[model samples]
Target: MDKFDKKILSSLHENARISYAELARRVNLSAPAIADRIEKLERTGVITGYHAQIDPTKAGLPILCMIELTVKHLDYYVVLERIRNMPQVLECASITGTSGLMMKVAVDTMPSLQTLIAQLMQFGDTKTSIIIDMPVPPRMPQLLADD
Candidate 1:
């Protein structure tokens, strides 16, 4: 991607709903040119789908926790599938180190979390930690400034 592309991406990362005309103004390109670049970015998979960021607490899922799991064997796709299908599981990663998998989960109540943990234990050993707070919020990747 060139300087103009980088500028476009940086602007979009800040606000995906930005108008093509406004984006063109920021990137110093014509509106149609900006649209074409955005289309190319989408086609090349540089720009993935856009989504709204929702607060879990306001969404009725206040409880947040992370689970580190160690599987008995390498054939853990079944466990992975079960975890993936769970609505409470927000994110899961195949991590290195002692744990084979790690997941971020959210639930409404303590009882629900306990039940989810119990179900997870059937697949492997699990270590869970409640998230007290997030000091630094998640952010999009930084782009190089256009010259």
Candidate 2:
């Protein structure tokens, strides 16, 4: 919530694997101070768990697609849960406008993509668009920072 906390968060967003000492080195604080600050950040929910940034193409997910879906006469949570359980599904979001749910899925090939789409049909009517390139990797939602 302070300047140093924002600095700690910014540094972590770039490299979550940094050690407390190393983070301290970058953030200009003592190792123990860094550790305590990080602990406080986590406890206060300013910092969450760290995660990996996977290379989806190399990880056998050569095809990445954005799926736009709309469901009828069903509880949204129920359908969302089913979509979450699908192996191909990577990310799912409920949004406004034309699409009710926006999801990202991976496939090895076009035939496999067809199968994935067919599976989604069991829950709702859907539209999909394959990703050709991403200019920027998705970043964490920038919260509590003017910078």
Candidate 3:
């Protein structure tokens, strides 16, 4: 991507709802050019789907926690598939550490969390931590190395 493309991505990352004309003004390109660039970025998979950031507490999921799971030797895929299908699991990832998998989940009540943990225990041992706050919430990374 060139300088214009980087600028477009930076602007879009901040506000996906920004209009093509506004993007053009910011990047000093024509509206059509900006649209074409964005389209290309999407087509190339550099730009995925847009989304809105929601408040989990206000969404009726007041409890937020992270679960670090160490799956059984043969149950990694099984555990992963089950967690992927769970609505309460906001994010799940395989990491290089003591835990084979890590997940961020939100639930309605403590009992719900307990139930979820019980289910996961069928596959492997788990370490869970309740999230009190996020000082640095999720945000986009720089488009370029120097950025």
Candidate 4:
């Protein structure tokens, strides 16, 4: 990607709903040119999908927790599949550490968290931590001009 593409991605990361015209103005490109570049970015998988950031508290899922799981056996994919199907599991990643997988979970109540933990325990041992606050929330990568 060139500088213009980098600028376009940076602008879109800030606001995905930005109009093509506005984006073109920011990147100093014609509206149609900007649209074509964006289309190419999406087709090449550089731009994945857009999402709306929601307040978990207002959405009735205030509790957020991180769970580190250690499987009993090496068949981690089996455990991953089970976790993937859970509605409460917001994100899960396989990491290189003591734990096989780490999951970010959101729930409505303490009882709900307990139930979810119980279900996860069926697959392996787990260490969970409640998220008190987010000093730095998740953000899209800052695509550099050099890249």
Count of clashes in candidate 3:
0
Q: Candidate 1 vs. truth: CA RMSD?
A: 1.6
The parts of candidate 1 lying over 4 Å away from their true place are: 144-147
96 in model 3: Cα distance from truth in Å? 1.0
lDDT, candidate 2, at 53: 86
TM-score of 2: 0.91
The residue-by-residue lDDT of candidate 3 on 9-126, one tens digit each, is: 8898899999998989999999999989999999999998999989999999999999999988788888888899999999999998789999999999999999999988898899
- Say which prediction, candidate 2 or candidate 3, comes out ahead on lDDT: 3
- 13-98: candidate 4 lDDT, tens digit per residue: 88999999999999999999999999999999999999888888789999999999888676677888888899999999988888
Model 2 agreement with the true structure over 1-147: per-residue lDDT tens digits: 777777888888999998888888888999999989999999988787998889889998899999998876566788878888898888988888877889998889999999988987877789999899999888866667555
- Per-residue lDDT of model 1, residues 35-107, tens digit only: 9999999999999988788789789999999999898786598888888899999999999999999999999
Q: Report the Cα lDDT for residue 29, model 4.
A: 98
RMSD of 2: 1.9
Badly placed stretches (over 4 Å) of model 3 are 145-147
Which residue pairs collide, candidate 3?
none
Q: Is candidate 1 or candidate 2 better by lDDT?
A: 1
Q: Relative to the true structure, how large is the alpha-carbon lDDT of every model? A: 0.91, 0.86, 0.92, 0.91
- The residue pairs found clashing in candidate 4 are none
